[model samples]
Target: MPDPTPPGPRAAILPAPVFTDPRVTLFHGDAVELLRLLPGASVDALVSDPPYGLSFNGQAWDDAAGFRESIPHVDTTAMSAPEVFEVWCTEWAAGALRALKPGAHVAAFGGARTWHRMVRGLENAGFEIRDQIAWLHTTGMPKSMDLSHAIDKHHGVQRTDRIVQTSEHDGVLGATRTVLSKGTPVTEDAARWEGWGTALRPAFEPIIIARKPLAGSIVGNVLSHGVGGLNIDGGRFADDRWPTNVALDPGQADALDMLTGTWQEGSMSRRFPIFRFEHKPAARERPRAYGVSHTTVKPLALMRWLVTLVAPVGGVVLEPFAGSGTTVEAAAGAGYQVIAIEKNADYLPLIRSRMEQ
Candidate 1:
């Protein structure tokens, strides 16, 4: 046979883009518009946490009470709960799914209430619901006991708020008693008091990992009980086990201990270290008061781990809703070519600044 032609530069795997003077191209408009301009099958992975339609507005709530107080200020009365979810999953997610490569994974972070609808929408869009990973955060509000009280109370008009207050009071009393009994330093022991009781439980958000079938081939049985199935790693079914079930309490002690040491700058040796960096109060601080601008910002370490798991070295990673550019920065750090798209013009500068640094 004649000598094989050398692979062209475009065909050759590109080197990982460096963070210093990185080429982070920003689209300062709607993501749907940006995604439409990009070539299909160009990305190796897709990761994003889209708007939950909850309209959190990024204000810091002191407690469940504070959150409740802020509700009147929000326009939640316009649409029913289910309607809001359908709009996000069906409308917004439709745009997101179209942006992914075949066999590529789209990890979307969402609350429990909307996860099922999201899965159903993804399945309808010809994507396989692979794994439902739990992203347990350290900051979360307590659960509400209103439903239980509503069931128990014979009054036609059930006062759910009263029950929640009672539960909160009990939790505080229990914590005070424990502190007195143990004589432990209040500052050190105070965290124990905020345990996940009926009223106040840690928030459990789910990260749905869905995959698009490769083009021109029959979609494999994604529900198969095998290595690449929905329960690939032996976790419970995605439908049954919602991410909200996982508590947002402090990470395991081992994980916390790993985060205590200072991270070495520009050292790839500590890639995907098991430590939980966002747990640190300083790291969680936000510059703006409204909507945190990026409240559900995924930790850089977490994004790095996910990027490495899904994309090979020098593979392209795409984040359609690149809020604050966490996915882009992490992808660059892990030796992956990144393409980030953000709708908010205000955040373009912030994203560019982070990537350059």
Candidate 2:
């Protein structure tokens, strides 16, 4: 049997500062190692997108390295296996829990396939499980392999190499070329799953909202430590609608009809209207000038709202898995003091450029 202990610090924990300012601080190293140096009960809120144990990045899958849109900069080393990844998460959560004040909230992003393991790990680390917020989007690409296509290729059915779809004119074809799929079809020996897909179309990502157990009642806790309440009014939607757990992808609002004022909830529903929103694209000049942003980078609008939802005005925020410093950018833009740490040094320059811009 494998030993069930979390790994110790990967390197020596240092107190030296990487980059520091009045509004923002940046660190490039192992998150758990860096987190161990911070004092307990220091940060007001925690928001981050940690490794979900899915080996989707370049280093894990050799067939997917160096793609233009793939995570060329991120080489995920913490996710060797699910159990090991869970231990990694638990270690960081323990550090984050110690760093957070009592009654503070944490909003963490997790992948759909590994969300259950992440939640269990966090709960074990002393966080009270509150809710799972889903961010829905329509931009997911399905990577399921077509079984029928593979079966045909196995039966000596060679796919069309290259062909010109152009019409022959005067017994001569044009000098241009256009290729089309040409493969044998599986008929009598077709399996039941021949036409069926292996996976569902991707849609939403789950964000777990959790909190540290308070030392006292809600009001008492807030009065004592200035933490423990959600900023509902400050983060509400327009037309008197309360904040909801659902958010939409960019340009998704146009497809929605005008929501009426008369929203009657069921007995089990929260007694207010739920609302969703679309994030407008950031100004083109910034991304164009700096090159495309991080592949999994959260939109600025969504990050801004999420930071405000948990962290109080002028409160200090901590993001341990800070990829490209999106959370740091959001915090600084919202006038909150933030500390951002990323394991990948490749993204440090990009974060600096984006934050400075």
Candidate 3:
């Protein structure tokens, strides 16, 4: 095997690690700054869920100073907000590239509205574009505005027929009750636009799988670097079937089984058991000591599967945008040394709690 490369400039000047164990290390700082501080070609794989620049639920980090709208002095003449977001992505991705070993793969989760921009950034940052994995879920809430309701409010019509509904959800940010729709449309124009909304119900999230340029041919790279190739056998399904690009939550898998039915081959009879999301952020997965305040915590099982598929055994895994420490937690649990970096100070406690567990 080839020797690991030496650390670059500023690699030694790392922020004091907030949490560290034999298997896991956590850093609290900017992702780009922390990523550049890592030794060159040290990390074996990267699995992150970076910001989508959507101003999602008015979160400040994802907004990046109102990234959706063009900010002053940024020169938005030639580039739109989405293009600007792509540039931001390229900056961090380039830093990630310096830290990753040759042939290391990245599984970065992206939003449907802005996935293309994120992919473009990764491509520009010297990573080869690989397959796109889709994770379908049944519990997707749409952030759409009702056009009919807006028209009614504009006309100042108060509908007598009003029904109040309370919705309780256990999401990344913990459990909460949301009251939806105070009233329905009342005016003629509102009636015409009834049932029309601004957006569609979200069902799936895309995970872009990209790889660093290999040092040599496939076999040669895998032998020397212990990466560049996926762990196909290790990632096989419970039924001993090969994995697919499409993943589904329990609800979606059950629905598919109902729609398409099952198949039998030889001694095995099983349903369409593609890659199912076996791990979720339920009471079992997350540490009960810390309340989950992070908005975009991915399913723990999904992250585990991603790391296992890409990273080699006993290799180091990196998560630049370590929101709630899901990626690091997954990697460490799967027996890989993990480095997690998060910028938000408030979330440091959350990541540390997971490490303690």
Candidate 4:
């Protein structure tokens, strides 16, 4: 890979490209800055998994409280976390709007709790709201707290029917266990909410698809800009089934099969309404030895499908939030011109390694 110095005119506002090859360019900096610096109407598509504003695992990058402080001219003191995140998204989405060519699309992943805020932000930034694609999975760990357990603890009552449940993961270092209550609730408040938890297990993540306004008609725009159209044939399933808005992992597909009573459509089976993706256990458990440790690494297969769906053949794909570089790796590996911007410098090495592969 070539670490070429940026041109003199852009060097003032832009840093040198960290890793630049014929197919890919990696930058180490804030996404907003890079998005602003990109040449207007130059990028063909935008696909990324930006921050979810959930402060996941206490990671500062995902924390909206501190992120709000960095948005210039925005007073976030009284704003809630989700509200602040909307402002942040609008800021970058505006930059993206300027950088993307007319009729290009943006495929962004968002948290379930704050997906509407992201959509609002995109709409606020002048992008036309398109359909939302659901990335269905069954692997999300529930973050709900047990109401009965909390009530019992607050009342100072010790339950004797607590049991430890352990599950070992493949390729993981050790087993993870949690305490479960099996005994009757000792307090009235505990008994009232004995079987209830705060939240349900997460089953799906929303992937928002927004598009820049077309210069003219869709056919005219595609002819002029080489974009503004989905690669449906490229994204088609086996037996020429057109891809649906729902993308499913193996677990989710299995669940849907159970619910609908079949998977593949045949003389003996019923057809389901899903586009099943290749299973990727490695997406959940990345190789720590390579220093690839982004907490929310997306499945490479899903990323590949997304990039192909939005971007035209051999066109430029911009990934503003290249966490773990899955989108970047997918875009580049699939033979598109890629520009990957990552805010956290710690993951740069992992991204470069992925590009080399």
Write candidate 4's Cα lDDT for 1-357 as tens digits.
Answer: 876976565354678899899988889987766788888899999999999888887877888865775585788889888889999999899999999999999999999998899999999999998899988887777888888878999999978877778876633324566676467788999999998998999878999999999999999999999999899999886557888898887667767676876545431122332266645446442524353467788877788889999999899999988877888888888999998888887788878777666
Candidate of highest TM-score: 4
Candidate 1 TM-score to native? 0.57
Query: lDDT tens string, model 2, 1-357?
Result: 998998886755555556777888888776766777777898999988776666654343112121111322334454345655565667678888988999999999888988887888788889998888888766565656666656655675644542337545421112333335434454444344456556777777899999999988999999998999899987786555677787766333323322533333331123222344333334431232234244466666677778898998999999987776778888898999998887666667767776767
Q: TM-score of model 4 relative to the true fold?
A: 0.88
* Per-residue lDDT of model 3, residues 55-94, tens digit only: 7877877875544232343455577667878877876788
lDDT of 2 at 191: 48
Residue-wise lDDT of candidate 1 within 132-170, one digit each (tens)?
A: 867666556544533333333433433323312123332
User: Model 4 segments beyond 4 Å from truth?
Assistant: 1-12, 165-177, 180-184, 263-274, 278-280, 283-292
TM-score ranking, high to low? 4, 3, 2, 1
Worst 10 residues of 3 by lDDT: 263-272
Instruction: TM-score winner between 3 and 4, please give it.
Output: 4
TM-score of each: 0.57, 0.76, 0.86, 0.88
- Reference-based lDDT, residue 313, model 1: 53
